[model samples]
Every structure is written in structure tokens, then in C-alpha cells.
Target: MTVTDDPVRQQASREATRWLILLQEESDDPEISAEFDAWLAAASVNREAWAQTEKAMGLVARLSPGNTSSWCDSTGGGVDMLRQPRRRIPKRAAWTGSVVALAACVALFFTAPSLLLRLRADAMTGTAETRVLHMADGSEVTLAPGSAVSINNKDGRRSVTLLAGEALFSVVHDPAHPFVVKTGNFTTTDIGTVFDVRRTESGVDVAVRSGRVQVSGGSILAQGRELGAGGGLTASVAGFHADERSAEQVGVWADGLLVANDEPLGQVVARLKPYLSGMVIVPSHLSSQRVSGVYSLTDPGRALEAVVQARQGSVHRYSRWLTILR
Candidate 1:
């Protein structure tokens, strides 16, 4: 029988939903023990519900703490967090399915089912909107203005396909499944870590923060390269290589922080483009000039001002955009 239609399974689903809300509340307020006690007393099913939810949620926690929504099991089968929605619980075989599901859930539940920890995202961001996403793996992703991405959770892997613009990924570590990120011409994989990928006019730019990543030209090219901690790479149709500063620059948006450690003035302007209100253009003469230091993304104008003062560069504001000249 379908889980929603079965009496016992229906009860479990209802109880699980209630516990989800309770767990979120408890996460926010840890001093609710007495409240929890009262909740448990409200129904004997409350405890059972809590137990089942705990099992499911725990599975998610073990697998990936970010995508908890995928663990709903309506068929009364013991809960196992999955990357996709559970198949409909068959009606005639309810008893058998529940037994088998429970057994499988227990085996899979030990490590947190990979289901609830992966996300399926298909979205587009407009010119004015900046999109922020929390992945199932406890990593955060921020899309630049006017960007789009598609996230897929498959049986063996978690993948993100960036359709346009730039994206930052801070991935949580899971040895069982590797996280893969794809852009127009590039594909990057991570066991667990953070990085940024941007599509530039000429080619793709990749920057790394924590952990390591392997970048291969996706479908566009024949080969890919690996990137280690603090490594950055820039590639076009022509080629790819190791870059030290670019990787660090890509992560600037993750914490609302910005930094340019001895990087070109032009490069810094390119990195700052997303945070500022208008275009930031550095003159060709200063394009190769190196700049260094940390700035706040919250105040790009101040950061711009600092760059001008320290580097003897002049700033010109025209409408919403700004231009810099040495």
C-alpha cells in the first residue's frame, strides 16, 4: 500500500513532519527540554515520530547536513534520506515493503542516505538579483547577478551545472560521494571543499580555498587539470595553468570579504565587478599594475578609494560605473 494511504505509515509521516519542525526549533533553542517532554506526552506517537524523524535526520546529518528535505518517506518504510523523492510506497505490498525498507534503511541509515544531502536546483537569476544557495553538504553558493545554474543529484554523485555567469561553492566533505561542478567549458570535482568559478569574456577562471579540486575541460576541450589548496587557474580554448592569486580572489565573496594580494589592478576591478553598483574599469596602462590588501565587499566604494590612495590611481565615476587610471 502507498505510505500515505496506509494507517501506520500515515501516522509515521505525520509524526515525522511534526518532529522536523520541532527539531528546527530545538536547533535554534536548545533549552526546550521541558517543552520536548510535554510534546512527547501529547501522544505516544510523538515519541515514535521523534524516533523515526531522528533516524532520518541523523542519516542526513551523517551524509550531508545541507539538503535535509529529500528524506521524506511516506510509505512507512523506515526513513532513509535520498537525493530524490522516494518512490511511491506500493499498496498491496505494504507489509513486505516496510520490512525490506526498514532493513535497507538501517543499513543505509548508518552513513546518512545520500539522498537528502544532495540538492536539485534549476534556477535563473536576473540582472538585479543575487542568488544565494545552501547545498545539502553544508556548503554555501552565491550566484553573481544575472547568473543561472542547474543542480542535479544522481545515484553516485552530486553535480552543479552553471549555465551562465559566476558561482561560488563552499562544499562539505563526504568521502563517499565526490562533488562535481561544471561551467560552459570547465568541470571541477571535489571530495570536499570551497571554490569559485567564473566565466570571463576570454575564458574560465577558477579559484580554490579549502581542500582541493580537479579541473578538466568539460565538453569544450579534451583534457582537465587538477588544482590543490590555495591554487588558482585561468583557461581559455587555448590552455590552462597554475595561478596563485586568482584562487584567493574568487573566494572573496563567500564571507562578504575581498582581498587582492599583489594582484593586477585590472584583475581586482574584474573581481570587484559583481559587488559594486556599476562597472569598474581600470585603464590599460594600470591593467598590469599589482595591488595588495584586503577590502570589505560591503563597501566597494571604500575599497576602491583605498586602492586609489595606495596605488596612486585616479578614480572616475560615471553614472553607476567607475573607472580607474594610474
Candidate 2:
């Protein structure tokens, strides 16, 4: 059981753990899905607990011994088809077959989540690659590498969900047809503008490059926040905060550079993930350390080393397949 200070949170965490196991063993069942969804919708705390459980599971897989291939079920059943993904599966398909590769395969799935992302996203980009997708409604979107989005145009309105990474959106102004970008708990409705939306581990970030945007969500954004050119805001679970940046500085990652201005070390590493070939293991303490610097996305390996080194941390590259940030 997860013994948290709050009793509500503790119970939610325990239920979330149970749901996670059920998902692995019988995820294909529609009844199981409905039950899980109902449980998740029962309370806000349940959603938070589920998110934490998933995060914890990912960490466990990443740090697990590569040679050891144990999982929840000893029979090695559950989610086998999606174990290896194309873009993130580092050129090592010839490893010892099936059972023995379970640990590494599961780790890759948890980290990159290629299968789920593919199923959910209509358009996506691979490592070290960005894509410019032109919407049917004359809007333009520049997807950051390792990013994916699902676009919908219906009922005279346009909707796009940022499934992973970040994206720069240039919407065509049409009051008759609204353009909205949704990520996590927030929905950024473009009031005729170019903007950047990034889905971080903690929450969603909204930045306007030109024109204006209307951000709406729960809590701080319950009343909606309007941002004009050069305006920025970060809405995290911890709370909402103002993080303003110049128009010129927003969406710089599309230009193949990671411009970190008082950003967390983990955020910096996350931005560079698309260009990196494999997984990066960043310690919690080191990841939370504040960092500020401009790093090159074209040469992500060196950039990662620089980010970690600035905090007196070391980067250990066991192989191109894994890089550990201490």
C-alpha cells in the first residue's frame, strides 16, 4: 500500500495499483476498460493516484536489471506485441529471443510508449525528426521530434491533442471555426494566433508567439486565461504560475535548439529526448535541480552531458542504448 499523509490519496493509490495489474493481465476486455474508467472517474484523487502509479511503474522498469526478465506474471504474458517499438528500439533486435528480452523490451515500452502513442496520434515524428503538417482547415502545425498529435476537424471547428512532446501551431483566423489544442487538463483555444503548447510531466505549458489564445481548465484556469503575444503560463498540478517569455524565445525547439531559461534539468532533458537515440535515466534530485542554458538539439548527446554536468552531475553512457544521468 502507498502510505501517504492523506488518507484519501492513500486509498486512491491502492486502487490505482490494483487497476494497473488488471490492465496488464486483461486489458483487451471491454468490461475491464469500463470498470477501470468508472473507478478513475469516481474522484479527482483517483486520477492523480493512477498517474502516480503509472509513473512509478515506468521508473521500476527502467532501473530493472537488463539481464533479468521478470514481470508481474511469471508466465511472461500480457502486452507482448507492443514490447518493441521501431524508433526507440535501438538496433538490437538480435538479442536473445522472447522470454529473455522481456525486461529490456518492457522498459522500452514504458519509456517511449510507441504503440499507444501511434494508436492515439494521427500524426507523429520520429527521433531527430520534426514534421510540418498542414491541416485541412488551412492551419499549420510544426511537431517537435518525438511528438505526436491527433487532429480533428468537425462541426465547423478544429481540435488537436498534444499526445507527446511539443508543437507550434499557426492557426488560420476564422471566428466561425474555432481552433483548440488540448493537453492534460487544459484546453488552449486560439483566439486567432500562433502559439506553442508543451505537455510536461507535471502539466501543460502555454505560450503565445503572436495574436492571442484562451486557456481554459480546472482550478486556476476555471475562468480561462487570455494570453497575448509574448505571454506564457504554466499550469501544473502543484498550481498555476506565470512564466512569461518573449515571442522570439517561444517555440525555439522547432529551430533545433533547446533554450532553457530557468528550466528544470528534467525538462531540459525531455526537450532533447527526440534527438537522443535511447533512454536517459535522470535521478529525481538531479532532475529537479534548476538549470539555465542553451543546448543543441542537433547534437543531443553532448547537450545532455552539458545539462547534467552543469549541476555537478555525471553522465554515464553504457551504450547508445542507455544513458544514465547522475
Candidate 3:
């Protein structure tokens, strides 16, 4: 049967494609190979998936270079199906169906689950809208614009999953029932405190406003950090940064304020992206510029204008939902 014909098989194929790409990209890294070995040994399905992926790769490798494009076109697929733009192809080889099919599988694997989860989240906010939720356990959570969260209080356990965006959590002190907030691979356990959690492209940002929190995860940045009031951590692909800021300033966005301290323009733009109904594009050149200031989140357009002007840059507005900064 074709991979697409069975959802379970399709998911397995997508996961296999991800591992194959990772192994190929990091072939020189022994750690990655070890991890891949562990993954392969974890389940029989994993081994089967890898075998299927290998067969697909072999099929592409056997194709004559001149006929690769013809094969892809005949299948109504293209080289662009691959989402990894940075992936390099050898100079002599042409686009083939194996690579395109694997890419399609991997792309679906990444997007489908997240989309389904977001649609099923218990609480969610749209662009520029903040929502305050009062839980049955007396805990309060303030969701930022474009954020989504799900709560579970089962068998005397309190758990919250940050599905998307940012939120400020004021968890009630319940020593008998520990409150845990999860985002990506990291988890934050409240030690009777108030904190803000934001999901970024690289990782998660956690800022403590009151009390303390224990953070643990596979990510090096957040593993085993006890953050107290006025303390913050930004975890990203590059690494982690621990900083100090006032508790009131941690989630000032809820008060119509955007605060930044020597933050990259790209990151600042990312923070602003949620509040905006339209897309905000920052060119790579301008993305690296440093910004530090307080802007009005209530009027994101004006705030964006001020940011561009401060960097001696320009903003082009295409519509209410589309903007470009260069």
C-alpha cells in the first residue's frame, strides 16, 4: 500500500524522513548517530520506517540524472516540495521523485499534528486580544494575543500545555497538587509563583514575576533552572540567556506596552507578529539590528513605524494584514 493510503504508515514515513534528513545533515556528528541508533532501537516501527526511507533513497539514487525531472513531473510533484531550503543537493544530480515524496511526507508530519491540536485547544485568543481565564482551582492565566492553551486537572494533578503563543500564569499555591506548564520540550513547575511563558521560533522564554519556578527539559537552556522574581530566561537554538527585569515589566504587553532591552530586531518583530492582523516581514539585513525601548502594543502599526524609524529603516504597508520592513 502507498504511504498516503494509511495515516499510521504516513506518520511513520514522515518521522523516518525527518531522521534521514537529520542523519544526512549531521553525518559528521557522532552524537546524532548515537541518538539515531537509539531511536531505531526504541521501536520495531522505527526500523521499518527507516528501511522504507532507505529504499526510497536507493530508488532515487538509481535514477539517471537526465530523467529525474521527468519522473517528478510525471508524478505531479516538484523539487520545491522539500521544506528544507538550506538542504544542499549535489551539483551533478537532478530533482527526483524519491526526494520530493520524502519531503512531502516530512512536511505533513510537522504541520498536521500542530494544526489539529491548535484547533482543539480549550482556550485561545485571536490577534491583539488578551483573555483572562479563572480556573476551577483558583489559578488565573492571562493569555496573550494569538496564544492557545489547554488545561487538565485529572486525578488531583494540574497540568497546562501552552499550545501556541504567550501567556502569564498566576498559579495558586497548591502543594498537594503541583501545577506544571509545558511548552515544546521544556516544562515549568510553579513554586507558588506568577510567571510568563512565551514560545519562540528557537525555543521558549520564561520570565518569573513573583515566587519561583523549576524548569526542566532536554533543551540545555531550560534544564534545571530555578528562577525567582525579576529573573528571566530566554532559551533558543543558539543557547540560553538569564536576565533580570522587574516583575511588572515581564508581561507588560498585557498592559498595551512592548518592552525590549537590547533585543535583536528580528526577535522584536517576532514578538510583534502575533498582535498584528497582517504579516510583518523584516529583511535579513535589518533583522540583526539591536533595539531597546518601550512601544505601545495597542497600536502595533505605529509601534512598528517607530521601530523602523529608529533603525533608519523604512516600512511599507500593503494592507491591514501585510507589511514589509526593509
Give the poorly placed runs of model 3, Cα more than 4 Å off. Answer: 1-117, 219-223, 236-239
Model 2 alpha-carbon miss at residue 48, Å? 45
Ranking by lDDT: 2, 3, 1
Cα RMSD for predicted model 3: 18.2
Q: For this target, which candidate reaches the highest TM-score against the unseen true structure?
A: 2
- How well is each residue in 155-212 modelled by candidate 2, as lDDT tens digits? 7769999998889999998897789899988899999999999888878998999999
Q: How much is the lDDT of residue 6 in candidate 2?
A: 69
Candidate 3 lDDT over residue span 1-326, tens digit each: 12123566666677877776565445556897788888788877777777756664553212233333332333444453233356655422333444555456555654565577677799888778999999889999999988899889889889999988999999899988899998988888999999999987777899998999988777584448899999988776567788888887988887889998888998888888888765677999999999999999878877877777789887765334457786
Instruction: Identify the runs in model 2 with alpha carbons over 4 angstroms from their true place.
Output: 1-112
Number of colliding residue pairs in each model: 12, 0, 1
> What 10-residue stretch in candidate 2 is worst by lDDT?
59-68
Instruction: For model 1, give the 10-residue run with minimal summed lDDT.
Output: 60-69
Whole-model Cα lDDT per candidate? 0.63, 0.77, 0.76
What C-alpha lDDT, on a 0 to 100 scale, does residue 189 get in candidate 1? 85
Instruction: State which candidate has the highest lDDT.
Output: 2
In candidate 1, position 182 carries an lDDT of 81
